[model samples]
Target: MIEAYQKLWPNRASVKNIRTQQELEQQILIELNDELTHPRVRKSKEEKLALAFSRIEQSDLTKQQKKDLVSLYKKIAAQ
Candidate 1:
């Protein structure tokens, strides 16, 4: 979604300039892959958990499933 893309790349000109959903997705994927693969750009555990939670919120899973998954993630993070 446009909102997700904007949240991920708030300062990216491409996010604002995208003319199609496909283009926006492509740009987002490229940036996400770069961030993920770049060793120096490692995200902290809490940041990763937050991103995961955001994704779970956006997914098509049932509310109960999302709740369970979030609880599981929190338990894992606490360890």
Candidate 2:
């Protein structure tokens, strides 16, 4: 669990008392939000693309949801 949290936010400080995957995930989100707010840390375009691709692949979304996601991804990629 700690390892998962560390993997999720490698550069952030180590988190303790995060036992389950869900808690680790929530802590990682908090860390990500903090990083996003900081001007010093900017996510690259490729990183954004990777995140988008992960979102498309990670969930059990419906068929139309997947199609809509792909269409949205295409629009973003076209920009």
Q: Which one wins on TM-score?
A: 1
Record all residue pairs in model 2 with backbone atoms less than 3 Å apart, i.e. clashing.
none
lDDT of 1: 0.63
Best by lDDT: 1
Residue-by-residue lDDT tens digits, candidate 1, 1-79 = 4554455446767678777766754664444345545678776667777886888788766677677656755755675
How big is the positional error of residue 56 in model 1, measured in Å on the Cα after superposition? 0.3
Alpha-carbon deviation at 4 in model 1, angstroms: 21
Candidate 1 weakest ten by summed lDDT: 28-37
- Ten-residue region with minimum lDDT total, candidate 2: 1-10
* Model 2 C-alpha lDDT per residue in residues 1-79, reported as the tens digit of each score: 3453344334655455667756655554543344545567767555665675676566566556656655654554455
Please give the CA lDDT of all the candidate structures: 0.63, 0.53
